[model samples]
Target: MDGYFPGTQSGPMDTTETFDSLVRAEFSPRTSYLNTASNGLLPARAVTALHEAALMRAEGRPLLPLHENVETCRAAYARLAGVPADRVAAGASVAAHTGLLALSLPPGAEVLTAEDDFTSVLNPFHVRGDLKVRTVPLERLAESVRPGTALVAVSAVQSADGRLADLPALREAARAHGARTYVDFSQAAGWLPVDAAQYDFTATVAYKFLLGPHGAAFLTVPEDFGGLTPVLAGWVAGEEPWDSCYGPVAELAHSARRFDLTHALFTYAGLRSSLELLEELGISAVHDHAVRLADRFRAGLATLGHEPLPAPGSATVSVPGLGVRQPELSRAGIEVADRAGNLRASFHLYNTETDVDRLLTALEA
Candidate 1:
């Protein structure tokens, strides 16, 4: 498997040995873990971090102050999203932030989205009775933007098909219409470079690609954006949450922390550890490795007389004829998903050429 794909390195520094070694060291060695799009596998270090934090709390000697740990996790997510720490807020889930962002828009705002986009991206706007929601195909999203459209919401990557959205083009169209962009990067954040500065608001759940627990997520909002108010405000959203009880007037924080929700501290602890690991590995390397593996997997499927769905540069591949064989494959320790009628295998940095080989062998069987 060493030279299966020539010139697959993203750069001179990216070698298969280094990539595989890191994956082997950090991730749990499963027979094959090809379902990262659904939920990522936490590294051993992250699991240990969660256990230690829980133990410290049980012993009455916490690892660090809760606020300090929260800030640390927020900073880690900020770095991952390539945004300033002040512009990032912690949320319970992508849906929570999406609802918050949708509610922040002006009354009767027109929101343009895609039909195939994640429900979290569309449901928030659709539920607003005063807002005008228009659903179009991803290819037609840019052209669907019109005057008076206040927001354009979409996912960075389609969850089922793994189609990457053209955020730059969408942003350009939205900008021309004076509309803001909201992106859910749940499938793209860890394996892809999501430009947080390009969109007005972006969110991703930690449990999916960030290799952390559920019930905690990160949202990025522009620091200078005005006219947006927190719809789900709590004491954490106040300017001085600790002194909120004594204040006669309620004032929200000047930063994106104004949207913060009470988070699960244990989840944040695991997220901090995993984020640190990802940062150390460099997201570029992780992305390149995942993409390379996906390319190889697609090529393998093709050789097996199974042409995958047309999803260019996607880490997830969908084979046409394997949908019915999903249960058998899973029984054989080859994990994947049956998305509609397509059998989908999602790759991550943890997946290797050997994993692809195993999948191909199972299909042949």
Candidate 2:
């Protein structure tokens, strides 16, 4: 059990080595994959891990190892998020994790949100019907936090154009107004450094920048549980799950485990490998490498008279009015997305200079 959750420690590099070896050994994309914002390509290790887990099921082997994989991922995410392992809860849907916060808010309380933030971050609040879901432009979110704001919900990185939220500013405003903050990190984690300790709560799906499959999510919460009543609590959320199996849970989990939904066991089996690979590479290195590629793409777009959405320091570049070319690019063997009328391409540690140049060449043709 102690071997389940591993610590993240990448020994110092003396500058002679590069991430080239690790990436080359781990990934072999058949096409130019620049769409990590939509979905990341799985590393070879994760693919192998998934296949093994499926085989275990086919052989009717004990699921204890796969169960162990969930703890490994949760711990990895906690270290990546700069939180305690006990503070992170495993789940499958970010919207479902968000529902905990939405349901916690009293009637008529306001949930301040960025106008175009991802829907999963805002939908839970709206579905509550009793909570006031206020929308302002992403740039105006921090300034818009008022005394009426009970919670400020926003994506750490805008899913549409990669615009990063002013988190430090938002935190300050929320504190001044005695409000809580919920940040969705689905678009930024793994490449952009995340510290969930700064916000009241944070949710991230493992499929995007984290380079894992869909259906695995992690949520971090305050140690005191932030007064959140787990409305969907099942037996897994019990203090002693096996003992609590037959009753209305005798005692809820003392930690954030109380918020745990059933683990996506298969997803977790693969995600453990993904998280391990990310930790080995280091987020700072990944950020610098990806952002450089994005800047290169932006420069190329400028030369082509194509202005991208203005998002400095982001690894994702979205070119407005070029969404119509998505199919052309795809046919040209480039993977990207047409998001909200923009051609969105995200660069990851696995992407190369050639990948960026190929997209530029396609755009020029």
Candidate 3:
């Protein structure tokens, strides 16, 4: 365990490994770009662990011992999210877990959520019935909470604008109206601090901030919440799986694990490795790195005589001048996401101070 949780030394291990590999491939010119937080680049430790797991799978190991990995990953995520291990559950994606929760709600109930939510969430809510959907301005989110609302769902950070939400306030409003709150922390996981024990339920994809693969996500359910249930449960979610008396009569697991209906041991092992790596690099450090980079980017954008979206203290900050045909910026190989007439730039730990400066210089040109 000491070897696994290397604390702040995790980055050094990666740095050393990268150095050694570079020595081996010294002659090869590399096009190094940071995409760890975006596409779930596994840390060296995690990659090694997953490789071992894959080898075991190739040998046809029975039962897979995935529960151990899942439990281990759950413990790490719980510690990071400020919740008990039992309160946390791992799934293929936050979308799957939240969708199960959404399905468990009263049919055709009004679910008040943000319009800027991630596409995974938007698609699920779109096909659901009895949805009284209202797109509220970011500033009026607190004022917009209404009575009889089934659920108040919002993203901790907007995937489009990279803005952080007032989660504490959102939680308060939902509780006041007797509505359950569900937060999508996909973009905020590694870059933000959250106490899941303080909220009704929170879901985030492991791939984004947790630095895991595509099929692993996590959800934290409040210790006591009756209105929300796990609609799509599986043998794992049910207790006494090996019991003779089998059927829907099986009792669900007494914790949030009840939300996990399908199991993917391969992905679970990979996620466990990633979670271990996250434990190594303390959340506080990771958040500081991301925020510093983002602040730098924001400052640079301002110097270019353009304003970012959502403003400072707004829900998010969409980059300016993305679509403009800037000669040097385009030639310099800078790219951004354009959505709803706004450009988006994201920041994370893998990003450096230099990256922001490069972006700023290119945009200025």
- The whole-model lDDT of each prediction reads 0.81, 0.89, 0.65
Worst 10 residues of 3 by lDDT: 1-10
User: Candidates 2 and 3: which is better by lDDT?
Assistant: 2
- Against the true structure, whose lDDT is highest? 2
Models 1 onward score TM values of: 0.92, 0.95, 0.82
Per-residue lDDT for 150-212 in model 1, tens only? Answer: 888899888878888888889999999898898899999888877798889888998877888
Q: What is residue 133's positional error in candidate 3, in angstroms?
A: 2.0
**Which structure among the candidates has the greatest TM-score?**
2
Q: What's the best-to-worst order under lDDT?
A: 2, 1, 3
Give the CA lDDT, 0 to 100, for residue 349 in model 2. Answer: 76
RMSD of each: 2.4, 5.0, 5.8
Candidate 3 residue-wise lDDT, 71-181, digit = tens: 788888888888888888778876676676667666677777776677666556656765666677665676688898877778877776766678778878888898887
Per-residue CA lDDT of model 2 for 1-365, tens digit only, reads: 12111122233322414456677789989899999998998999999999999999999999999988988998999999999999999998789988999889899999999998888998989999998888999999999999878999999999989898999999999999999999999999989998999999999999999999999999999998887998888988998877878969989998898899888899998999999988888888788778878998999999999999999999988999998899989988999999999999999977877888889999998
Residue 26 CA error for candidate 1 (Å)? 1.4
Output the TM-score of candidate 2. Answer: 0.95
Relative to the true structure, candidate 1 reaches a TM of 0.92
Superposed by TM-score, candidate 3 places the C-alpha of residue 204 at a distance from the truth, in angstroms, of: 0.7
Clashing pairs in 1: none
